[model samples]
Target: MNYPFEKVADGAEETKLIAEEFAEELNGGDLVLFHGNLGSGKTFFVRSVCSALGIDGVTSPTFSLVNEYHGEKKVFHIDLYRIEKADEFENIGLYDYLSDEDAVKFVEWAELFPEQLKDYDFLITIEYIDDNKRKIKIERK
Candidate 1:
């Protein structure tokens, strides 16, 4: 519930609780960048936040590049995992989604293009500690 919050989630349920608390501080037009490796629960964290915001059936946007959801507020979920070039990023019209003023945007693997993602409200890093535990850090700018 605080800026620069850090926690170690022992399992999915604990992660969900943390995400719920984090969601409480969110607002429409906020940009949240997620930094983590593969299978590090980046998408799961976003899903949990979406759920707390009254959205359901949240899934990774790996293939589609982005997913939109309507809840208490509009939500834009984006994944940069499959994108390997700046041109590809531009071709997908991601800039438009990033600039949406009526939606809360969550971008996974944002570290992939730090230069392009200069402005963000929150930066969350999820670290895989083991099969059941993850270290989550959230920083507000």
Candidate 2:
């Protein structure tokens, strides 16, 4: 539960750079859960990761709930912000994305269903300190 990999992003540029580097370490079937408040750079990090993985047009899936991308590896960007219950996630087939053996999944607003998300590759927490300052902590689970 200790986050040994922690980075302080002074601005969006640094955050993007961290995400790009983080993307390089990902392999297929990696599950990354993002924990942060709204506008705390969760989506921004996802965008950077997707871009580094050669996926284009990466956007926040707040409304759509899930976004799929095909890059060096298949990637699933899931936003659970609109999800109010665990059953909602199950009903929408979000688990289908996690079941992919050859894909990487990044989930935002993952705190909503912590019980169901105990098993994961990495858990990312982005804490917003100021307008352009964020503390990102990556913990391996």
- The prediction achieving the highest lDDT against the true structure is 1
**TM-scores of the models, in the order given:** 0.98, 0.95
lDDT of 1 by residue, 1-141 (tens): 776899999999999999999999998999999999999999999999999999999999999999999999999999999999978877899999999999999999999999999999999999999999999999998
lDDT of 2 by residue, 1-141 (tens): 244689889999999998887898798999999999999999999999988989878999999999999989999999999998888867899888878889899999999999988889999999999999999999888
Error of 1 at 135 (Å): 0.3
Global lDDT scores for all candidate models: 0.95, 0.91
Scanning candidate 1 in windows of ten residues, the lowest lDDT window is 82-91
Root-mean-square deviation of every model: 0.7, 1.9
lDDT of 2 at 62: 96
Global lDDT of model 1: 0.95
Q: 16 in model 1: Cα distance from truth in Å? A: 0.2
